[model samples]
Target: MTRLTETARGVYVIAATPFTDSGEIDFDSCDRMVDFYLDAGATGLTVLGIMGEAPKLTTDESSTIVARILKRVNGRVPVVVGASAPGFAQMQDLTRRVMDAGAAGVMVAPPGSLRTDDQIVTYYTQVAEFLGDTPFVVQDFPLTTGVQMAVPALARIFNSLPTAVCLKHEDWPGLAKITALRKDGTLNRRISILCGNGGVFLPEEMERGADGAMTGFAYPEMMVSVVEHHAKGDMERARDLFDAYLPLARMEQQPGAGLAIRKYIMFRRGIIASPAQRKPGANLDALSRAEIDTLMARLDRRLKELA
Candidate 1:
């Protein structure tokens, strides 16, 4: 069994997958990104998440990344790997593979292109059984999963898998549903909620009772600062830091920009290798590039001022 430390509720960085010019998974750069998040004091590193381009990556690549991250992390914190796919069998196999490769936990979503609630539950049920009580995070990405995770479904799945530990809460309107579950005593007592929506609404969600956030393109210090300050009862300072970084979040989160833009910002921040994306169609035009550059420069200067 992969030993899992209790990951503190904070901004866990979705470590972006870097690619070589020849279109290969860059393990060297992937390690660097993991280290960056660790040094930033992230609760953990979520590899192959949406921000990590989970959908586009191949199964081999996903398992390889999980294995490498597991080795690099060395049980310091939870390493959650994505095992989502369209087929239940594939996801089950992927989950088992990643676990065998030493992942501390796995995060999965409803199979892509399948909207049936029964199918979603069945898929998760099968994956959970195969994984044999391993901790899992239910990743709610309605924008892509096509199935909104209603409260009933969440309850049913969690009831079935007693070991389900976390929820990667992404469904917006449904976010309230989760909070309702917690408020009304419907969810399991051990289940912790993590925000996976790019940290845009994290403060609001935190106020609403979320455990922590899973953000991509995170500068660990500021991310941790916001959460820690709030935990320290300094809501004003937390809000101030949140506002200061809002522009950078908006710039890097443009639809197609996803992980590519995250990599670019990390490069601009001098934390990674080239910002080259593994696949095409992520090419940013001059306007987007200049916008990112300007925003990053301003954000960097602000960081210095804050320091």
Candidate 2:
């Protein structure tokens, strides 16, 4: 399999699931979206993520989407599938299906019920057993998962599980965690640390030793450029580019309405044909749409100035 490892860096775009106006999975748009991400300089692709609207899809739909994406990617870059489920049996089954379909790896977030450090470690230990050699990413975004994994607990997970290869670190204001993990002797093994708070904290996270970003922002080129500039030690250039996109990024990250905003942008950009989400998802109103249009226009102007 195409396994992810410590050396993996640069933007691994969290993909959005495309749907028709009638709520059917838009397979055609899926192909277009994959191509768009690669052309925008994504080093890898992560699908079925929180923002990918994974839970909104049925098991058959999930498998079909992953299969479609893997075929489109065709090994150009690694594809990581989110395999987090309430039960290990479901998680394992999903992992096997995706891996068999040629996914590079899987990502798992702690269930919302996990509270203490021990509980987090125990959960991952079970995850490692269930996965059985499939490389996985530890998604530590307490704001959404409601499970706070402290540094020591994470250290133990990294030390114990050989297959845990990366982190989608999205702990809000969690720059300190990145600093702590990168400190010498903190983790038994080195793993790629990718920040994922909508790339809002990417600049600080990189400064604190994060490899890059693995988040969903409408304009992934912004993330790609920021990570590249940071790697070249051009902090000023990185910050300039990040700042140019920050307004739109922040707007696209609204808790209940973020995905709608993102899909609207993608549709406006022609990456996807429609801005539709499955049932139970909100669609942007005229006011929200107008605001996004304004931000995007400003983003264009700022990018031109930077150039």
Per-residue lDDT over 225-275 for candidate 1, one digit per residue giving the tens place of the 0 to 100 score: 777887888878888887778897767656776666777777777676677
Best by lDDT: 2
Q: What are the lDDT figures for the candidates, one per model?
A: 0.74, 0.92
lDDT assessment of candidate 1:
0.74
Determine the backbone clash count of candidate 1: 0
Give per-model TM-scores: 0.90, 0.99
**Clash number by candidate, in order:** 0, 0
Error of 1 at 261 (Å): 1.5
Candidate 2, run of 10 with poorest lDDT: 1-10
